[model samples]
Target: MSSTLLFFIVLAAMALAYYIGRQRAIGVVGGVSQINRLHSLPSYYGYYAALLVGLPAMLLLLLWVGLQGQILTALTLAELPPEVTADLSEGQLSLLTSDIRNLASGNLMGRDPSPAVEAAAARFQQLQQIATLSLWALTGAVVLAGMAWAWQHTKPSFRARNRVESILMLVMILFSLIAILTTLGIVLSVLFESIRFFQMVPWTEFLFGTRWSPQIALRAEQVGASGAFGAIPLFTGTLLISFIAMLLAVPVGLLSAVYLAEYAPRKVRAWAKPVLEILAGIPTVVYGFFAALTVAPFFRDLGQSVGLDVASESALAAGLVMGIMIVPFVSSLSEDVINAVPQSLRDGSYALGATQSETIRRIIFPAALPGIVGGVLLAVSRAIGETMIVVMAAGLAANLTANPLASVTTVTVQIVTLLTGDQEFDSAKTLAAFALGLTLFVVTLVLNVIALHIVRKYREQYD
Candidate 1:
């Protein structure tokens, strides 16, 4: 059975268990009228029974689903003759399994399968059927056993509420650990692969070298494929675009925020805020198309008219569109932060004979500065991490220049390029993606720390 259908079956069983347990609790107390004799409420008994019925079945399903793939693969492969499997390497074996999987799923898109692969695919389907049947049978039996146990224990003196709460607490902890462990697993995997990449290419060169070519020589005879692994150009381009974006985003977004939060009429604020924030809802690819088709062309033509060189895909166009895109993030957050400032500050400034502008500059703006900084920081992150816009508007050339008019690329674009298509995971080229990911992580972390420091330094405390 499919997991979703099985889950619903379990849910139905839990409901049955709950009803039976509630009836049993009432019976043990001599009737519904005498239910006060029970240690916990009858509904608590019902909840306890539902938990008992569901938990064991869910665990069984999870374990079965986890091991089902590997077990079936092994059984399918084993069904093939020794001669069929004897010479294939691990990558080839993986591909064979993939083909079998696709074929069993009726994908029928890849190369025609050999007789051995056809046999394996059939066997895989058969094993999958058997495994799913066994899963359903085992889960049903466990659910029945749990219902019986709960029915037996649903008595007047049972502390059903306490036991159910304890079980739920443990489950909450388990889910929390799942989230933490998932993050840890991702970090460790990237770190290990980055270590492998650094072994193949020097860390110093990757970090500080100005040249950014990553086309490593495949054979000793290849002349132009000598790799230069410097990431300085990637970082430079990322910052230049992000810098341009922030330059446009901050002042306009901040001032607009101030206006909306303090000066705008309620009627205007109602529709205007959502309209302004519509930019954030627009897809990045749409922004990319706009930049490539309209913004980039306009910039190139304008620059040409002024007798200045401008690449077809320049950082300026991408950054401007990106700045427009991120405006909502800055405006919405800053407006909310400004509105959060106590009205007493404004009142005090007015009482001291200060004008509205003076009150905003001296009191409200300063009070809201930390939160505004936070919004701006989020906008900066958005600009830095954006890929689709940069891909379309800024051409993918990792030129080590400070010029925003020149075509350049960010680390994210290169990461995507390196990992695209069929790749040997152990190759230095594929592994470079991990190194770039790690670098981006470190840079973002540093930015977060610096932003936090600034926020703390200028933070205003209120009574």
Candidate 2:
């Protein structure tokens, strides 16, 4: 059976177990009015039974789903004749196994299959059927066994609540560990791939070199194919665009937030806040279209009218649009932070003969400074990581110029370009994407660390 179908079946069984366990608990207590005599409530007993029926069976299903394909492929490979396998490399063997699976599933394999492959395909189909049947039978048995055990233990004196809570704590810990381990796995994978890339291209050259070409010739004799891996241009472009975005976003967003939070009327704030936040809900691709079609052309024409040279696709256009896109992120968070400032602080400032503007400037803004900074940092990060707006508006020319009217490309755009098609993992070009990713991760992590330090320092002072 499909995993989804099996999951629903397990859910139905757990429901039945819950009902039975609840009834059993009531029976053990002699009457519903006598439920107070039990160590735990009837609902707790039902929860305990449902968790018992679900957790173990779900765990087994997860394990089976994760490992079944590998086991089946290994078994199929072991059954293949030595003549068919002996000459095959690991890559070839993987391809052969894929063909067998495709053929067994009645999908086109793209090539005629050998007699040995046909035999293996039949065996794969048979084994898959048996695996499905066995999984269903075993899961059902486990659910039934768990339910019976839970029901037998559902006595008047049983600590059902404690058992259920303990189980829940363990599940929570398991999920936390899964999240931590998954993050570690991603970091390690990117680090290792980046190491491979650095081995092929020197770390110093990749970091400090000025040229940014990443195309290498396939043949040694080919001309003009020596790739340049200097990443300075990419980093410069990213910072330039992000800086422009923050320049446009921070003052406008923060001032707007201040107005909405401290000065605007209730009705105005209520309607205006949601209307402003609606910008966040629009898709980034739509922003990209606006940047490329409307903003970029307008800027180019305007720059020319003033006798200033401008690229058709320039950083200013992308950054302006990106800043507009991130305004809601900053304004929403900043407004909440501003509103959270103690009313007494504002009152105290006013009692000291300070005007409302002076009160906000000295008291409210400082008190909410930490959260406002955090919001700005988040907006900056969003601007830095944005790919679609940069891709569509800021033409992918890895130019290392500070002029906003010039074209530039970002690290994310280059990473996408590097790994877009059917890429060989071992090639420097593909490995470079991992290097770029790792670098971006490190840069973002550093920014977060700095932001956290600032927040903590201010938070301690304020608290």
Give model 2's TM-score versus the native structure: 0.94
Candidate 1 per-residue lDDT, tens place, 217-258, comes to: 899999988888899999999999999999989988998999
**lDDT measured at residue 288 in model 2 versus the true structure, 0 to 100:** 95
Model 2: per-residue Cα lDDT over 342-411, one tens digit each: 7888888889999999999888998999988877887777887899999999989999899999999999
Candidate 1 error regions (>4 Å): 19-27, 30-36, 102-118, 452-460
Worst 10 residues of 2 by lDDT: 454-463
lDDT of 2: 0.92
Clashing residue pairs for model 2: none
Q: What shift in Å separates residue 335 of candidate 2 from its native position after superposition?
A: 1.0
The lDDT for every candidate, in the order shown, is 0.90, 0.92
lDDT winner? 2
